[model samples]
Target: MFFTDSRLHFFRPLVGKYREVVVECVRLLYQKLYTDLTGYGQSHGRDFVIDVFVEAIARAPLLDEEVGAPEGRFKDARALAGFILNNLLDNGWMERRLDEATLQSHYGFTRMGRGFAQPFVESGKLEYRSRNRNTRNTRNSLQAFAEKGEVYDLLDALEYSERIISDFADTIAELEERRLQLVREVESRQLIEQAADQFFDFIDTVFKPDLEVRLSADSVEKYRDQIASLIRQVRRRRKYGEGEHAELLWQTVMEMRLRKLLPGRVVEGQSLLENIVHTIEERLQSACDIMLPALRRALNSFTARADIIIRQLSYLHRQADEPLLDACSRLREMSPDNQEQALQRMGQVLAGVRSGWPASEQFVLRSRNRRRTVRATLANAPGLDRDAQKAQFISQVLDQAFHVSSQHIRAYVSDKLITQGRVYSKHLAVQDARQLLALAHVVSLAGERLDNGFEILIHPARSDSAGLQVFEASNCGDGYFDSRENFELELVDRQRAS
Candidate 1:
């Protein structure tokens, strides 16, 4: 009961906060429900609705027309407008109020309707005609970090991203200094503990966030290059027209004017451009100069050092065991005979004898189920014999070479030269191709004359008649055969026997 009471009291404030959030969310959902009553189906014009809501006046003349006689089944414009207002009121999207002074009725958005529409107005989504305003806002923020002066003045935006890089370098430098201090001198336990906490905080807040944005020395160098390039563009403002990049540079110039840094537009000061360029390069150099190799070493060893310190601290609290002390005393007092008897027993247990069981012809189970295995050849049944496939492949290669009398060995050996049946290309992979060539080479060495009227000959792959022409296979990914090596295949003309 006490635990339940404590838990209930602790969560009372959180429950109250959650209830308020739920009410706000429900109000938002009702406002953005996109009812047919808004007289705006999915195809309704967003701009017209926004203008009507913001300016409190309808753009279309038909919407402002007063009630008149019904034409066919159609009601008058004023009557139709009243029907829509009544629908919105019923849906909790709008409310009708009576003015005490004038004693007149007026309509406006309810709490739900105002809250829901506030986000679109504030985010500039309503101002932009396109529905992809969210994506555009995100892109603009990213571009502000990249190209010159997108979010702020040209000089100031460069300084902002540069400062993130500088802060990252400074954090690494501080970590290095602490590491050196701990290494060189015996620091107090309290100091070491504080340093450890700071190390964890650095990784969480500064280190991780910087890495997320890639605010490193290498990134700083890239930013420096971009800044320098922008400065050059500003210096040569006369040559370039208002192209895409030139327009962006002009925007930065405009931002500078707004900040009162530039006078009378047209950024023509070459000296000022050079000064800005120099300052960016100086900041980049300072960031890159910081060498924090100890950061990695410290991270790896920090845990191990803490573990060692914990063990040392715990040593003071470790209690001695009386039973273990008694066992040591007993071991010291043991006689030689008793020690020999104990050693004999231990040796007998460790050097265990091999126990042999009688060999049985069969094993009989108490109850066994009569298994009915429905044996059938599956789709993954064993493939056709590989030797027949290899021999057929070799035959096909030789058949293609039969047309050319005394064919050059290298001609038939290559995957490119084998045209008939396309054994190398269509049917077989590289390993199979190599096997086919090698088999053909062996058949040729036997000096066999086939029915195709050509005698197979194998020779060393050399320029001379005595040496054979070597055919090396392409590199096989499966590594089934030796890729490097050669043997020539030549189709020699057979002599006519009378």
Candidate 2:
């Protein structure tokens, strides 16, 4: 067991393997979290791991308070690191990721970041990488790259959480102040209404039209119902000496009564309610005429602007680029209908993108399993085109953009199109997997001009110089998922000698 010496900035004489186990757990959880987040219908999430981290220790009833919050959450590199250290101070290795079976439990290492739902989720298949098709490589890649991404960001976020909270606090404080002002304005408006006409304007209207008069019981019943509705509104607003608001509302009601009374023409054959209905109709019409255009323009203007960013991000998602979600901040007055429309639009576009296009001579299969081929039976069909690829390679671009190597520039077909009798084999070291995961970030960057499909050949080109060569996507008419930092496909082994 160990206690933290806050001054020294290290755990004081911690027991053996405790720190290592803690670090490994943190790393595993973070990696798994992101993978699962991108993965659809996942049982595990960052939230689950965070919940475990909090509950494993006794920080019960986690509060969303700012300031005087855990300072340790700020300085530690890994989110769970401080919590683990604190646990060491309190208890020993009780239970967590200290065993094999527990590690392989639910929310285990199997989940891959997948709903993503635009291009990836629509087609429930992994990217068209050459190696992933071979069961061995697929298993190896998932096992290897599962926990690396957490090392990059989750730890960073945890270590700097306090700073993030502090920044967020300032923003919330501003909103709170604005909210107070709005409350006061509403209170004042209520006071003015009580003195002027009625405290609640909506319920104050006590009269409505009663035209199409008749003598039968059904017609009489309708008129009676209208009379009850009108009386209910009048009574609801008629609070006795409540406040300044009530006084103002009372005065306004009296004035309205005076206007309808007209010098004691109480003996008139026409009802007082008929005149009141005419007044209410005129006012409601005036408000609608003035407000309708402005409301529509505001809604349309915001949707039009937001639709641009949303559409672009949706397309980029197909290309497997990191979606810029903050783009939605530009959207104002976003209704449920708008959201459904945009999401459906993305699905439609993805549907049109027939998989394994340039590589497959003709679309075939009642149910295509692999990410290869979709033969549509149409007499007049459009030419297989990839003008977008040419546009991407148009101008001299960034390093990632220019870095297609040369199998990358060439055999750009789906992996299922690999030669008929060729077999894939790999003895990929764990270290090589780590290196590839790191390089995934470099390869999937924004300016990358990879032609949607490519191959990475990892072989010993010389006696000492075993290296990697990327074949560009020359045959791929179009594709996405080049931005995958956590995954990659490489021709790990190849030999024809029997």
On residues 1-498, what C-alpha lDDT tens digit does candidate 2 reach at each position? 122232232332132333344434434444445545344565453345555454433322223444443333444234554455345323332222433654542333311112111222323332332211111222222223222211222222222322322323432343344334434543453332232222122113311111111112213222333433433343343433544546555424443444454556334565443443333333323323433333334335433533443454455455454343543442334678886787677677668766754657565758757886888887886554588656665654543543543343223322422443222112111133323333333233222333434323332222234434222333221222232112233432223221
Candidate 1 wrongly placed segments (more than 4 Å): 1-152, 173-270, 291-498
lDDT tens string, model 1, 1-498? 522422323222112222232223323333344432354343223333233332221322222222442222225434433433444455555566787886766555656556654553444322212211221232233345344444344456445536644445554565566456544332564454455565556457644554324434334444545554544554553422355546455435544444465444335544444454456555545544542233345445644554544554454234233544554466678898886776577567768767767567565657887999897966786766999889999999888754332243344344432343122221223345544554444434347566767555544445466554333344433344454334444455565532
Native-vs-model 2 lDDT?
0.35
* Candidate 2 segments whose C-alpha is farther than 4 A from its true place: 1-275, 318-498
TM-score of 2: 0.14
The alpha-carbon deviation from the true structure for residue 174 of candidate 1, after best TM-score superposition, in angstroms, is 4.5
Please tell me which predicted candidate would have the highest lDDT against the true structure: 1
**Number of the top-ranking candidate, with TM-score as the measure:** 1
Residue pair clashes in candidate 1:
409-489, 459-468, 460-467, 460-468, 460-469, 461-468, 461-469, 461-470
lDDT for model 1 = 0.45
Alpha carbon lDDT of each predicted model: 0.45, 0.35
